[model samples]
Target chain A: MLKNFADKPLVIGVTALNAIDSPGPGVAVIRALRDGFGDNIRVIGLSYESLEPGVYLHDLVDKTYQIPYPSAGAHALVDRLQYIHGIEHLDVIIPNFDAELYNFIKVSAQLRIMGIHTFLPTHEQLDARDKMNLSKFGEKYKLHVPEAITIYKADELRKAADELDYPLVVKGKYYEAFVCQTLEQAHKAFYQLSAKWGTPIIVQKFMKGTEINIAALGDGEGDCISIIPMRKLYITDKGKAWAGITIEDADLLDLARQFTKATNWRGGFELEIMRDADGKLFIMEVNPRFPAWIYLTAGAGQNQPEALVKLAMGEKVEAFSEYQVGKMFIRYAWDHITDVSEFQQLSAFGEL
Target chain B: MKLKKNIATSENGFIFNPSTGDSFSSNGIAAEILGLMKLGRSADDIKQHILNTYDVEPSQLDRDWEDWSMQLKDANLTEL
Candidate 1:
C-alpha cells in the first residue's frame, strides 16, 4: 500500500553524514529509509567533509557525493547540488543538518524544477522555534519554555544578569552550550561561542531536572503522523545521549501533539524537554530538524523519515497508532576500515 | 608509549578499555597506528611503518604522531 513519485525507482539524498561523538541524524535517517523502503529505494549520501563515516558505509549507502558546506551559503550549495543532481537525478533530498536547513528551504522551489522533492517547514515555522524567538513562541502558544534572554554583545550579558541568577546556560546560536556559575564564566562562554557560531548568544536559566526528548513527524495539516518519547539514560561528556529508553508518557505525547497542532509543523522535529521536580515540563529547546537519536523512532514503531518521504511525494499516510514501550537504544562506535584510495577518490573527484 | 593493559582493539577500528568501560571508534590510519603501539613499537618505528604503508609525508606523520599520543593519553588508553 505504497505509492512512488515516479514509475522508476526513486533516488533520495540526505546530508550531514558526520556520525561521531556529536552524531548527525543522517546515518539514523538513512537507516530508517532502508527500513521503510527495503531494496526499492536507492540512497545517496550527501556530505560536507571527506571523512564523514557514512559515506564509506557502502552497505548502508549506495553512492556518496561531497557537497559544499553551509558556510558557503545557499547559492553555492544550490550550484553544487545541481551538478550532483545532473548525474544522480535525485527525486528527494532530505537535508539533515540544522545549519543547512535554511539553505535547503530557500532552494526548495528551484530544486523542484529539477524534480527534487523536499518536505520542509516554511521559514516562519522554522523561526517560530528559534532560540531567540522561543519566548514569544511560548507566549503565543501558551507553552512553557525556560526563561531565556539573548545578548548580541557579551557585555550585554551584564544587563540581563540581575534578572537571572547564577549558573545559567550560555548557548550559541547554532550549537554548543556551557553552564556559567559566575558572571565571569558566563562572559567566557559568551565570547568563545559567539566567535565560533556568531551573535545573539542565548543565556538561559539553568533548570535542574530530568531531560526528555520527543521526536515526532507532522502531516503539515496539523496532524501528528508519529510521536515517540525517550528519556536519556546515559550521556557522554559532550552531552549527547549515549543511551536512551522509550517511555510511556501520555502527557509528553499530548504536549507533542499540541505543539504540532499549534504550529501545524511539517516534517521531522525533536523537542528538548526538561521535567521539574513538581512534574512540570518546560520546553528547553526546539530543534527544527530530527535529532541524532532519530533511529529510535523507527526502532520503536514509526518510521518518521520513511513517512516523511511518502509525505514529500504527496502520498497520504495514516497516523502511527502506537510504539513499543521500554525499548532501549545504546549507541556504540565501530571502526569502518576502508582504504585511503576511496577517500582520495571522493576528496579529489567529489563523487564516490 | 605502550597501550594500556586490558585494552582490546577490533579490526573494525573499535577500541575498548575494559577497565573503564569506555569505547571509541577511530579512522583507518589511527587504528593502524594503534595496532602498532599495542605491539610495543617505538614511535619512530611506527611512523616509518605508517609512511611505508600509507600516503603521508614524514613531517606530517611526525606531527600526527604527537597528536595521537595526546589523544591516547587523554583517552587513558596508553602508558608512558
Candidate 2:
C-alpha cells in the first residue's frame, strides 16, 4: 500500500533487540503503528531470545520474527537485517532499542540505499535523547531548565553535590532517574546507576511541581501538527503516568512549539515539563521516541504513530486541529490464575 | 467494604473535594460507583450489581472495588 512512497510494500523492520515480552514504550508504539496502518505495512520484530515474542503481535503486526542479538558488535544484527531484506522488500526500519538505535543511525544511509527509510535522528541529534545533553540544550535555547550538572566519576558527583542544594535527582544518562531524598541516597543512586550504565550521570536540583508532558510529532524539519499536553495526575513507582488528563494549556503548547523549532527536531518526541509552585515551566527531559502512553494520545485523538509513519514515508500528512481533551487510558497485563487475581490484574483504565 | 460520602463528582468526570482541595477523574465504572455511593449503596450491593452485569467473578470484583474505594477515601475524594 505504501509502494507509492517507495518501491515495495511498506515493510518496516522493527528491532526489539532487547527483552521483548514487557510492554515498553517502543513496543507500544509498534503496536499502535500496526493497528493504524494494518496489513499495508509489514512488521518484522527482531529480538534476542527465540521465545521472547512481543506481546500484542498476534493481533497487531503482519509477521513476527525473532533474531538473536549479537553480544559483541553489529554483525548479528546486520546479518538479521540481510535475512529480513531477503524475505520481504524493506521500506522502513524502526529500531526499538537504544543500543540498536546507536547502531542503526550509522547504517541509515545504507538502508536508504536499499530503498528503506528509517526515522532515526542523526548522531549529533541523538544527543537530545540524553538527559544531561537535553539540559544543556534547554539552557542553550533559553528554555527554563533546573539547576543541573553532569559528572562522570563518583568523586566528581560528590564535589558537584557539595556545590548544589540537597534533595537532588540522580539520573541515568539515557532513560531513567531517581530522586534522592538525602545526600546518602544520592550517593547510593550514583554508584548503583553508574555501575550499571557505566557513564556520567546527571544530578539536578529537585523541583517540586505538577509534572506535565508535551507529546508531539515534528516533520523532522520545523513544522509540527499535533500538540497533546497531558497532566500527570497519578504516578506509578517507576514515574510513569498512572492517570493523566488531556489539558488544553496554551502556554505549554507554545513552549513545545518553541522548543521543537529551536531543536529542529523531527519524529515522535515526548518532553517532560515541570510547572513549579511559582507557575514557572521548566523543561525536564526529552524522550526521542514515543512514550509508553503514546497509544493513549492516539486513543484520545492525535494518532502520532500513524502520522510519524506517514511522514517517514514522505506522504503529505494532515495537521491535527483538535484532540479529545479529557480522555484517559490504563495499562493492562496478564497475571497468574486465581479467583480474585483476574480482576486485580485485568486491564487498568485511567483518566486521560 | 463500603464507599464513603462527600465525593463531589461531576457528570464530566471532574471530582472535587472541598475538605482536601484535591481533585480526580473517574472513568465510566468509577462514575457508576460514585453514583451508587451517592444513593447510599453498600459495598456488597455494588459488588452484586457489578458481578451481575459484568463478566467478572464476585470475589475479584470485591477486592479491587474495596481497594479502589479505600484509595478514594485516602485521597480525600470520598465524603467520609
Candidate 1 fraction of reference contacts recovered: 0.00
Model 2, stretches more than 4 Å misplaced? A5-9, A16-23, A49-56, A67-76, A336-352, B1-80
lDDT of every predicted structure (CA atoms): 0.88, 0.69
- Docking quality of model 2: it rates as incorrect
| Candidate 2: residue A271 Cα off by (Å) | 0.3
TM-score of each: 0.80, 0.74
Clashing pairs in 2: A220-A266, A244-A352, A245-A352, A327-A352, A328-A351, A328-A352, B5-B79, B6-B79
What does candidate 1's lDDT look like per residue over A8-29, in tens digits? Answer: 6679999878998899999999
Q: Lowest lDDT 10-mer window, candidate 1 chain B?
A: B14-23
Cα error, candidate 1, residue A215 (Å): 0.1
Candidate 2, A215-260: lDDT as tens digits? 8877767767677888877777778786776776668888878877
lDDT of 2: 0.69
TM-score of chain A of each: 0.97, 0.86
| Candidate 1 interface RMSD value | 11.7
Clash count (model 2, backbone only): 8
Candidate 2: deviation at residue A96, Å?
3.3
DockQ for candidate 2, please give it.
0.03
